[model samples]
Every structure is written in structure tokens, then in C-alpha cells.
Target chain A: MSNAGLDSAYDVAAVRQDFPILDKPLPGGMPLVYLDNGATVQKPRSVIEKLVECYENYNANVHRGIHSLGDQVTTELEAAREKVRALLGADEVEEILFTSGTTMSINLVANAWGRKFLRAGDELLLNEMEHHANLVPWQQIAHERGAKLRFIPLTADGRLDLTALDDVLTDRTKLVAVTAMSNVLGTINPIGEIAARAHARGALVLVDAAQSVPHGLVNVNDPRVDFFAFSGHKVYGPTGIGVLYGRRKILEAMDPFLCGGNMIRRVRKESSDFAELPSKFEAGTIPIAQAIGLGAAIDYVQGLGFEAIAAHEHQLTARAFDQLQQIPGLQIVGPGLAHRGSIVSFTVEGVHPHDMAELLDRKGVAVRAGHHCTMPLHEWLGVTATTRASFALYNTHAEIDALCEAIQYARQVFRRK
Target chain B: MSDDLYDDYILDHYESPYHRGHLEQPTIAHEDDNPLCGDRVHLELLVDEHDRIKEAWFDGHGCAISQASASILMKDIEGKTLDELRDFQAKQMLDLLKVRLTAARQKCGLLSFKVLKTMVYTLDERKGAMSPTQGGRG
Candidate 1:
């Protein structure tokens, strides 16, 4: 594929056109000013049409069917896996396992690897800012395996207290699970540094890239990274399909997570053997069309290049900070713009997040409001909830202005008597 | 998508709620939250010898709709019999707000109703009258 972004100037209008939903007028006639990218991004036309194409043609079960359509579907399926493997810079396609989403991917490791290795006193290092997807699975597995959960304290600014890494990364720490970017705080963590520290203590690192992978470049082959997980929907791909890249040696040694028809290598009435690296985990007829759509999404993101995506998103984040902070009572949470991604979570002095979100929605700007699945982080921030306006490559500076305007409107409505 | 969602009437109740503080020596009380958005409601009622509401007060933090719902609920429940309070429905609360709400926002509008329902139900159970206390939820 050609370097589409490298060869030309980054055009927001062109990027917006690629995603049909971005320009569409809402039912009330206002233009859609979608800033909920941190939750699930708007899909480009290519990914949408690719899903339609996959369903229209070669609509058959993969791997088992001897018919022509079956072979075609199987080829497309494996090709999609290969695309994901390459996207993550893994050593082989076999190392990439397609699950339902990042939640399922993390659960697989927690069950397959965690259940096998965790002893009663063994510790799992996590942080307060982690999304529920990263925090919950480890909590479940730790509870089941009689393991202890240790949190890496956050600095008052909401960034992880890396200075205290030595305090938590002890020999008993079996796994260090963390999000590459704070979904609530927008803090970009130093994953490579964290991994190095954890590895020194013989603990494996699992990167929850659900928020990070979609906005920037990520290579699972980073030697310090033992496993990486992300959802396709968050990256402008179809929902119900996600990726889990595990170290080859680690995956080969662990027992399978799910058991069923397509995941077996051979079966006897009394005994059965499991399939290979990916098939061992993919039990039923997988999300065939969604996986292919995810491939298209990878191609779409690759064509845009992460450098352009990051630069554009940083501009949006900066605009939001400059304008949002200027709002009399608004306090932006998480780290400052220099240390974050495109996400900006904040709370107005007088308005609640739910009210803020509703008022913003009235202006056709869709932002998420709540604890954002990080109750601990919200508690640490000493607020019940915060309004988040997360950006993507297709977002414009005008959208940031609209967000600020909506906040002003909300403030006026909630101003003291 | 209309600013009318939080218009003058709703904002009026939100800014200067009629019963926005705690009540002392309340006969019935309950506290609950909308886990979906962390919106909470604490409703307290002081009842007379004949099971009629003498006073109603509320304490909580949340969106305008929920807070306003409680503020108005305090007005509607005063001097109301426990039976009448039990008969109060989620739709009535929305109707009182004078605003259109989607299903999700309806939860915010009904948060006070939820706390009030629980408080009344617990009272009914104590009185051996557990016949589905509150009307249909929003």
C-alpha cells in the first residue's frame, strides 16, 4: 500500500468525508458534532462497504467447508488475521487471536494464564485510572485464584506515580496490567518503561490498548509487552470483533480459554485435543464479517498514518484545553495536553456531568458523561462524574468551539440564583 | 436535542429547590443512586398519626432533572397520604417536569421517585401491606 498520509497534506475535510456519519445532519437538523471517539469511533466508508461486501459475497463458514464460497471466506478470514498480525507487528499471524473485544481478550489471559499461574499471595499490579475492561477481568481472576491486587498510586495530577513502581513491582507480582492511555484522564503512560521495570521483577506485562491503539501506532512485538488487547469498534472497525496478541511462547504454554467445535484439533468421545494458536481460542463460527471489516479499518488507519492522526488529534486536544479552561468554572482532569492523547475530561463548577452532557447534546455535540467506567479515578478526582470530549482525526477545531459554547450555555442555565 | 430539556421551569426548581436539605426525625427515609451515571437521591418524609405526609425533604447530588424531580416531589408529597404517595407514578414525575426525555434521561427524572418508592415499600412491609407499593417506573 502507498504511504497516503506521508505524501500529502492532512485534510480534515477529506478525512471527514471518508466517515459518512461525521457530516450527516441529526434528526433535528443540526450537523453531527460527534466527539465520542474515545468510546467508539465513527466508521469510514471503506470499513462500512467492506462489511457489506463480505456479507454479500462468500457468506459461508470458514476453515471447514469444502465448497468454493467456503474456501473464499476462509481465505478472507485468515487474510484478516494476517493483516491484524502485521498491524501489531507481531512475529506471525498465528500469534493473533480474534475474540469478541478487549474485554474478552483480557479475560482469556486472566483465565488461561492467570488461573494457571496465580498462587494465593501472588500480586497483580494495576492502577486506579484503568478502565473497567482492564481492571475488572484482573479483579475477577485475582478473586478466583486467591491472588492479591495491588494498585500503582497516581500522582496528584492523575498520572501514574512511576517513581513508586519499585514499591509495587516486587517478586510476587505475577502480572502488571495497565492501560496505555487513560480513557478518563487522557494520560499516555510510559508503557516501555513500565514493562522494563515489571520484567525485571519477572512479572509479565499486559497492555490494555483499547484506548491507545486506535489513536496511535502500537507494536505488540515490543519484547517487554507480553500481551496486547484492543477492540475493533474503537478503531473505526465493526463491533463484536477484537484482537489479542500474546507472546508466542506464553500462548503456546497456556491452556485454552474457550472450548467448542471449531477450536479442536481432534476429538474423541471421551477425550479431545485443542487446535493451534488462534483456532484454540476461537471456538464458534467467529465474527467473520466483522473481522474482515476490521481489516479494512486497519487499512484505513494505516493509509492515514499514525503521525498525521496523532498530530491532528493533538491540535484538537489543545484547542479544547485552551477554550474549555477559559470557561469560568471548568476544570480539565487527567494530565496536561503535553502528556495526553486527544481525550479531555472535565467538570464545570456548578453543572453536573449528566446535565452538561444533555446540554451539549442539545447543541449536537455528543460527549460522554459519567465516571467513564473509572469510578476509582472519579473518586480520586473527588467528583462523582466528568464530561469527556474525546477527538479523532476527522474532528475539527470548530467542533471544539462548539463544545466550549455548549459548556457556556450549560453554565448559564445552571448559574446561581 | 432541545435546550427546552432544561428550560426556565426545570432550572428554577434546580437552582432554588424547595426541599434541598436533610430532614430531622423523619418517619421514613431511603437513599439510592443511578449507578449508570452516579446520580444519587436521598428522600426523607415525616408522617402524621394518620399516615399523611407532614413534611418532605431531600438530599443528594445529580443532574438537573433528578434534583428538580426531587424538589417538585417534595412539594407534591407534602400533606399527601402514604397511600396517595404509593399511588404516584413515574409518568407523573416526568409530566411534572414539563419536558420531553429520552429513556436514559428519564432515569434522571425518575431518580427521586425511585428513592421514594423504596422508602414507601419498606414502610408498607413493616405495616404488612407489601402489595407492590409504587406505580410503574419510568
Candidate 2:
């Protein structure tokens, strides 16, 4: 229960207490079984409280507000920016720009970065496992710019096939946009090495860390990634808040994605220049409460410590993989790497993923089914869909056991008919 | 919490479903999916020479509400004509769910019925003898 103890060890019961919504009841007299953390995690009381406190105590506009309440809110906003900067290990707070989650963040890069530099006959490298957020924007940009879009193929084990990197990373390669960890397969890519390769080719690297940040450690400084984007909601924070971290020098050199009030340095009727590194990217009125809540969520995560969380989730994932293997015909996807965080996706013979999810739901066990927004990967693996059980800090071995039993029950139920 | 929303009979059929596979000479076949959740159901209709649904078979994979709704629908319009099947309303699907479905789950519950109706409408377009091989799903 102590903070020091929590920072070093795995304690599910203690961690579960932090999330009040997890104890709520459902319609069928079932306790809430939230295994859809990959979509959006349940926020802790700390995050909720921080949001409420910000709204009640310091409700005012940030940056341009000169009044008392505005000053208070602006100070809190800057503090939140600092927290995000530390979370990502960026050089300074100016590098972290708040956006309305990953979609907007990606769009900002596509509009500002893609629109400016990429040209016709140039190529942008992408992997098969990218979420639609990462793929579509780049594709649209490529279509407009008349640039060629190339794919870095996936391996049989579901990891990015870097063997073809030599071919993929051509001199004309403008950018390499890839996911650090796939939301569907939970496979962690070698972002550091991939960034190095792309950088050697004079191409920038944009990492989709939406799935990776919540599960394990992420240090943009260590990886030396050019641009990193992730959503707060996926990491136990409130929705409508995300971060876009660009290297300081790179951000300063790039044009503003949006031209508006706060992001402007000085506005004459005729002409104006944009603000510094982050404010230049963040144009409109920001999600103040959500940003403060995300700051709290980051603090909560750091307090729990990534090493301990990883160790705990590692144990639970190993147990889940082993238990699922014991089942007769279930096939676990991805590399089964022990270092990867606890995201297990699989399928059982003769049982459709949706049917399996339903049976599991009946047993008060929750699991996500279907393509998980990575349809191309599913197509590559020759499965229409798969059931995914993604674990969080509060998830327990007991939950994995329950999931296994429910899946077995599903097999038996379908088999009987 | 309405009994009409999640009837025990519906849940019973979901847990121990009936007529859950391909039918012999299925007159009409339909498949539908929830793009968000990836839930899907396939409805197979066995119609007689009189253009009446003589037998109704439901198959494919989905959640309890969707599968049960499909089962309950098969039971409701088993002996009805295409007109009666088409006349089937959203309220009937809600009544079959045995509990009020949210806006999202409501679509999951109604998709099978919609797809089946579409299939029946499409079937009327064929001029020649409808081959049994044509009855097979995509």
C-alpha cells in the first residue's frame, strides 16, 4: 500500500483500489470487466480528482489570459506541459504540444511536415501494423503531394521485417512512420534501431506510441525519434487530450500546422509570426481539464514505476500465454516475446472471435474481439479476426484464469451444438 | 431492464442456440457485420415453392444479443412471406433483445434482420431457376 513498495512490486489488489469505476455493476448482475484498455483505459481517482479540482479552482483561459484566474490556469497548464515533457524525456517543455489525441497530432505532422517537404516521386515508408490514424493521413498526403507510399513488410512472427529495410529505406524515402507497439499484436518494434536506420538515410522518424506508452517505458531522448505521438486516454487519463513531442530544433524549423490566437507571436492586420516550438503547433483553445488530468495520470504512472508495472504485466502475460496454450486449439499471435508487455491476441478453432467474446462476457470476463483496427495484419495472418486480452496494471492472474476458463467453456458450448 | 429487452428465452437461445449452421437448399442467405466490434451473423432462409419461408436457419458468430436476436427473428418469421419479413419493425427486434440495447448494440441486434430482408429483396431479381450453389454464402 505504501508508495515506495508500489513503485517496486506488482500489487493488483492495491492498484485496483485506485480505479473506482472498476467496482461498478452491469445490467446482468455482473461486475464491470474492462479488458478494452487498449481502446481506452479506465481513469484512476487521481486523474478524475485533478480534473475536477482544476475546473472548480482555476477555471480560465490559458496563455493570453491576464486576469487572476487566467494566470492560475496558465501556470497549471505550463506545469502540465512540464510533466508531459518529463514523461517523454524531451529536451525541454517547448517540445511537447497538446492536441486532441493521436488523430489531430498525426494530422498536424502530415499537414506541416508532409505538405512542406514531401514531393512527387518521393517515398514514405510505413509498416503493415499501423493504425488507420497513422496510415490514412500519410496516404492522403502522399496522394496530394504525388509521393509514392511504400510498405515495410511484416514477418511471419508479426514483427516488422527489417531484412528488407535496405530496399525500403531508399534515398528518396522522405519519412518512416511506424508504430512502436502494435495495438493488436502487442509486438514492440525496434524503434531505436529503426530510427537510426531512417536517420542514416536522411529521413525523419515518426513513432506512433499510442499503444506503447501505456504498457512500458518510453524515452524519446533515448530513442532519438524525430516526432512521437500518443493519447492520454490510452494511458489511464481522460479523453480529448494527447501529446505531440518534436525535437526542439526540428519543431522550430517547421511551419505551424494551424494559425490562430495563442500560437501567434505578434499579429498585425497584415502579417504575423508564430510562437515558439510547442505553442506554434497548439493553435486553438486547449482541453485544460483533460491536460491537467493527463499530468496527474503521468504522475500516477511514474509513481507506480514502469519497471514494476512491466515486471507484473510480464508475469501475467506469460501466465496468459501458457494457460491459453493449454487450451486445445487456440493460436496465440505475435512473437510471444517475454519482454513485450501483456497484450495477448489469439483465436480458437471452430469458434469465431465474436462468439468467444460473448461467452467470455457471460462469465463476467471481458476481452476485445475482431481486427482491433489492424485489419491488414489480420489479413496477413489469414484470420478474419482474433480475441485480444490486453492487461493493465490492475489486471490480475485471476482474470487471465477466468478468461481461459471462459474460452474453454465457449469451445465446449460451440462444440456441443 | 425491461423484460422485453433481455428476455430469459432470448438469453436461453443465445446460450443454447438452435439451427446454427448451413441449411439444405437455403432460399435466401444474408451476412452482416459490425464494423466497430467485428460482430457478424449469417441468416439462412429455406423457402418453399409458394414463396413462403418454410424453415429458417441462423448461423455465423456474434455476441449474445446479436445471436439471440437472430435466433428469435428466425423463430418469429419462420413461416411468413417476404412481405411479412420486410414488415418486421425495429421494435420487434428490441422486444427480442429482452432488454433495451444502447444505440450501438441496437445496430448489432438489428443488422441480421436488415441483411436478411435485403437478401430476400435481392432473391426476387433472379430470373432463372435459383441454383442450390447460388444459395451458398460468399
Candidate 2's C-alpha lDDT?
Answer: 0.82
lDDT of 1: 0.88
**How well docked is model 2, in DockQ terms?**
0.26
As for candidate 2, its clashing pairs are B4-B98, B5-B97, B5-B98, B5-B99, B6-B98, B6-B99, B7-B98
Candidate 1 regions off by >4 Å?
Answer: A1-8, B1-3, B129-138
lDDT of each: 0.88, 0.82
Among the numbered candidates, top lDDT falls to: 1
Is model 1 an incorrect, acceptable, medium or high docking prediction?
medium
Superposition TM-score, candidate 2 onto the true structure? 0.84
- The TM-score values for the models, in the order shown, are 0.94, 0.84
Task: Give the DockQ (C-alpha) for candidate 1.
Answer: 0.72
lDDT of 1 at A46: 98
